[model samples]
Target: MHDLPARLPGAQRNLLLKHLPEPRMLCTMRSVKLLPGTAFFTGRRSFAAGVSKEAEPLKKLVYISQSNDVFTNLALEDWLYKQGDFKNSRALLLWRNSPCVVVGRHQNPWVEANADFCAEKRIPIARRNSGGGTVYHDLGNLNCTFFTSRDEYDRKANLEMIRTAVWDTYGLDLVVNKRDDIEWRGQKVSGTAAKLGRDVAYHHCTVLVHSDRSMLQKALRTGGVKGGYESKATISVPAKTACLREAEPSARVSDVMNAIGRVFLQNPIEDKHGNTVPSEAGGYQLLNPSDYWFPGLGSTRRDLASWDWVYGKTPNFSFSRTYSLPKAHNAGNNPQEHGIASVTVTLHVTNGMVTETEIKENDSFSQTGGSDLMHISALKGQRFTEHLLDAAVQRTVSAAMNAYPRGSSGNHRAFSPGPRLTQRSLIMESERNHDPMDREYVNSILTCA
Candidate 1:
């Protein structure tokens, strides 16, 4: 045998020295040839091989699902980031939702929602966890979610990938509009949002190809004076919104979805650990709970649907404003009944501003009587503003407190300050409502701060 000194490198020799195991036993059954130089080199090779075997391999391809609701999709994406599930996998989520208006997580829903219009049409209003403006969606809309480990997540690159996928499948040159939307020609076709987490991030977009345009318009009211019920809310600019059918006249929702799937399948990349990763690869799945219908879907629909979550979460406060109006004769047969109207209004509020207001009729001898009372009541819970509060006070004077027809009266009286609650409070309540053993369920989902 060759001498070990002739083959073993100095670094390898030093490494062996550092990790040398304790000498335990020696056997002397047979006479063996002493190969002075070969033992060290052979031992070093064995050590190197052992270290390689001990290392863990990286995971690739993360399975994701298409959700049926926008809120559920947003919630699940938030859940994935908090769970650190994106540490080593890439996710593809498919999702859709009923006709509704969705506001960016940081946006004010009141401003984004057309309360009068939405209420008339019975469109649901929801807030997402991502940062963006308001968007409308229906069954015809398709939502896509892309999830990746925090270290590997790249918002710009991911967006490009999506743009490329659409272009490849439809042969349409879709441009990223306003940096947050995808547009065909000059009209917006998709609205995008993103949420970042400690170990992962998610980017989702609403594809309004074949969505119901009329319902979308009805669900999202575009024009309204800013303030009061509409204060600080996101407003959609008037635009001739079009569906994929209207735009292409030949494209369908399924056609776009299929095209997306094809693009992802055709393009694959290697993950951080050098493992080959596939896009839109099948194997993506979701963990179905005992109640699959609501699996991963929270009780938000029920809780938020309740007046408790909807209005009860508002902060506590009040608004006060004084107004003076010139006297005028009644248009009816009562000229002598005409008199100057003077009013001082006080409103109760909660949350960040006035969520509810209570108007105290300070002067009983005023000409408008309780006519102004109806208008003051409407001002409650509305954000405090010089202009809005003044207008509300004026409406009260015009109607003459009693002039507000019964039933025609705004439901301002129906609002009540029940309890002060937050997202945390709701989660706690949900846990108490379930079995103690399932507390983990609450813990797992309560990850969103």
Candidate 2:
């Protein structure tokens, strides 16, 4: 190490010695090579043209988010990726959110999350700009997003830093698997997803510190039957997950956050023969997610929290479900004689709106005016809601009964399907009706939350 510095001129050697006083510290400063006529070498590459054209040194940054709202953090990330400069700098953002479920860009929320359950639990669901599987987040989980220029983005290096942080801080050995997930004892402790833009790219991951496993399972696992969906959307691969606290009893969310922040700023160094070591440091800052802090961030947050981006962005898909029509919606057919009439509803949704709706009835239902009941073109452009499925039944059944008034056998009273309701009118009517359950159902499907 001393010899390397001696190779430089007197002024350069003196400056080098000033920064790195101890001999051992000089050895750790291997990134600072002795380039001729260069006072302090920083970048990994040699100067292409001359010393005057040498690029600026890479600046490592660790930013801790002040907001725990998922939408705010997501918007902050989006804003930084679109607006911030990372030409000669790398950033790592550490954040956590209140209980929420974040789905990937191309993933379906109905397939990725249990909507009715999440709605009842009041857990907001959001879709990020990145493409990957869905993940459940809460205060117990820690999120780390590594940002760099498109050419400088190194996902493996970021994962290595996280792996080294866990090993160094908690003495827990974690390995980066083929899927780029961090695993400990064959159980996932972290999940990775990334987005690569033309000029910028970011690799963000979730670190399960002491997250609620039960809630994670409930939030991620979709309930009800699953075979109806037919789409090219990305499906989440469920893995056996373990938390950092489970492996190291002493580990806490704050401790892991600080450890990752420290590791990120220090920028871990790898030695020959594949050994890890500590190296030089960088800057750290705490970022607050607000309009005052980040201008134009409010609009991005609103978009992320909007239904158009969250659910409307889902890939085109078809869903089929068999629903038993209510006795009143039997189209004047006697249920005791016809056995309960069930309709097979097949919906083709494109851009979150119903492009086509096909309802197939059984032989018992076909005995009545099933053809009239199948023509539900009125719901052509409406937003999807399994809860409002009964509306379709009523619409079709009213048409069937009105087509043949004397075909009725039941003593049921007169029924009305009322006016056709679009997505906006459905919510407004639900609110105006002041029915708590109806409003809750509408909110479950219509609201972004």
Candidate 3:
């Protein structure tokens, strides 16, 4: 382990103080002094000290944020990921989220999580620019990120520091499995993933503090798969996960984080007998990520939080599922009140939009499942996105309606119920008042796929 205790003594020797210009400082109003060895700095969380305006290379530093907003916290990491010359510096970021499910960069959101549940509960699904299986987060979960140059990207060493810190502080035995996951007894305590840049790389991991296990599992599951889905998108592997509090009932996130920081600081600044200790100057810098503190921080957060990055980046994938249509085929009918026939929904999405779709309505609109829809050529070029799916469905319904006779009550009762099941009604039926599992199926079927 790095001799942290020996490294922190002079951690702040070169500290310089600087304050943001009054006009752009939305979060802070006072001038702040930068931390020792300070060079570049930037947040709204709280400042242990301030940031230096100098260009000197900073030594190892530690930061802890009070923001639990996943988007904001993840954005904070973005600053470290894209900025700074990490070659000679090591910085650690500790954060937590309110309650969310974060997926890897290349994974499929539809396949990796219960997107419907998250949406219904107003819980956001965030995408981090790293490759790893899905992980659930809540206030009980602590995120630890270590930033270093590509040459110094050592995940095992970082994991060891956390493991050792917990053990050394609480006398708990945590095992490091072959995958580098930290386990208590046989259950996982932490899971890690990383992102590599041209020069800098960061390894971030989730430390289960006292998370809601039920929600974690529910959020990570694809809910109930109607039929099946196949994709090259990374699939999440199941592991027995336990929280730090499980082993030490009294453990707190702040304390655990501090313990880890202590171990990092204890690393010898020089050799085993070196006189310098970086921790003396190094302390937790509280940051609320903002453009004022870290330039472009907001944009990075927005990019990460945007639909394009969160869902559009998903690897091209397909879902083939069978569902049942309601009997009330009429526009004003309550889908849940009547029994209908079986239907198949096949969606081929690329860039998280509808590239190709096949919806076979066994009992479509009480008609013979029209042959006219054959050449509708479908939403092949538009986004099959979460929020946009309904609009697409509206367009499809309009086209299909137009294909039918107007005032057709004369011959086809199917064509006459238009007034009751207006465009809005159809949209709601598929989204609500049905089995949540098949809601998406209903919505896509209406896309006339």
Candidate 4:
């Protein structure tokens, strides 16, 4: 962890000092200073200090009002990451952004979104550095971000807190489904995703109680296969989404917000952490973090909004099909003589060597020949020198020849070669051959037969 500055510029540090009820909380914020230009509240302690010689550290809570913009959320997350707040404090941020489609970091947004539709409707698209499917958000949706120390964070526990809060507020039994979705009456109402940092983590989720289901359906259309090529991509099965208002006609966004606030207020007391404010001191005031906006920080409107980052990150591979003539197909008199024995192999290659392979063949030659070509194609990108290929082919051909007598008709049987080399390796060899700036191309010779 980077050491925090001893003193920060301006009176922002003083704000925290003034708000803190207990003197000990100052020690925690004293080491670091807020950035020179930003405004932050200081000096309000979250927990009461004990008089005993050994006192437990007071817990700090920062409440931030929600923004209806995607860029604002990204900016807050980025600022928290830089300030190291993710390591020290727990943050509860509330925001209901305009309609948008948020995609996981490793996901292909093109597969998860209807870009043209979203563009036409003016709905923003965001990509987060988390592992999960895409989710839809709108003003009617509530987004809660929980930032906590990695060591103390429990995803399930945090989710349960939200569940308990909703249940207590609305008397609805929202069940957590197998896919980590919060559902009511078989309709999905919320979805969550988490991003883990080195010493901290951020878990955020969307509550869909009042979002426009029709808009979501229209904005999340699936595009057909790409490049006249068909390969598996991450897929999301659309489901019926409902808002809390549908089930409880009396429910409002304000009611939900109050329930959430109650959950946070009751948290400290329930956890055996005494409240710093006395009963006479009254209910804790929920203060909104100062508003600071920067257009450059809006990734949803810029980089994430681009197709290059969403689709270009996908790993590239090639699938090729080859065919041969079966003995029956080769015979002039046979009716099947014109039929072709075809094989289609799909190869996945990374760093040159094939990592995965699949093969499919026609039914006519099934009995005569069928091998795990899928497994063989896996060797397509494996580094093999000319010497190695020559040796292996010779050894295999010699073995097959020795098995049959030279005078036998079977001895004339032709030997079929293995799968072709992967494109990456061919490109590397070609580059090495023609590039004037090329350095030595290291060589490896395989003696394996």
* Pick by TM-score: 2 or 4, better one: 2
lDDT of 2 by residue, 1-449 (tens): 44342445677666666654233112122223222222211111112112233443445657777789999999989977886666655678899999999999989888889787899899999999999999999999999998878876778888998898899998999999999999999999999999999999999999999999998888776442274888999988889999999988888888888888888877654433466543234444566666754678899899999999998998999887665432324334443332235557788988888899887764355444455554455677888765555566545443433333333433222222223334455545445544232443333333221
Reference-based lDDT, each prediction: 0.51, 0.70, 0.65, 0.51
Reference-based lDDT, residue 213, model 3: 90
**Candidate 1 per-residue C-alpha lDDT over 1-449 given as tens digits, one digit per residue, 9 for 90 to 100:** 22233334667545534443332110111112211111110111211111122242222222234445545555555544554344433556666677878766544455557766777777777766666677887878877777776677666555566678777666778777657677778788877778777767788887887887877776665664334342343444555555666656777776776666555445566555766653333232332211232333365434534444433443343345444432322334343444333445555545434556555443344444554356566665555444455555434333342232323223223211112222344344444444232333323222332
Model 2 regions more than 4 Å off: 1-55, 222-227, 268-280, 324-342, 362-368, 371-377, 394-449
lDDT of 3 by residue, 5-92 (tens): 1222343322221232222212222223344454334432322223343443336667777678888888888777776667556788
Per-residue lDDT of 297-406 in model 4, one digit per residue for the tens?
44434554454444444334333444332222134233323233445445553322345555556446434234323234435655322223323333322222222322
The most accurate candidate by TM-score is 2
Indicate the residue-level lDDT of 400 in model 1.
Answer: 41
Which wins on lDDT, candidate 2 or candidate 4?
A: 2
Which is the winner by TM-score between candidate 3 and candidate 4? 3
Output the worst ten-in-a-row residue range by lDDT, candidate 2. 40-49
The deviation in Å at residue 127 for candidate 2 is: 0.3
| C-alpha positional error of residue 170 in candidate 3 after TM-score superposition, expressed in Å | 1.6
The TM-score obtained by model 4 is: 0.54
Q: Which is the better candidate, 2 or 3, if ranked by TM-score?
A: 2
Off by over 4 Å in 3: 1-36, 43-58, 222-227, 269-281, 323-343, 359-382, 385-449
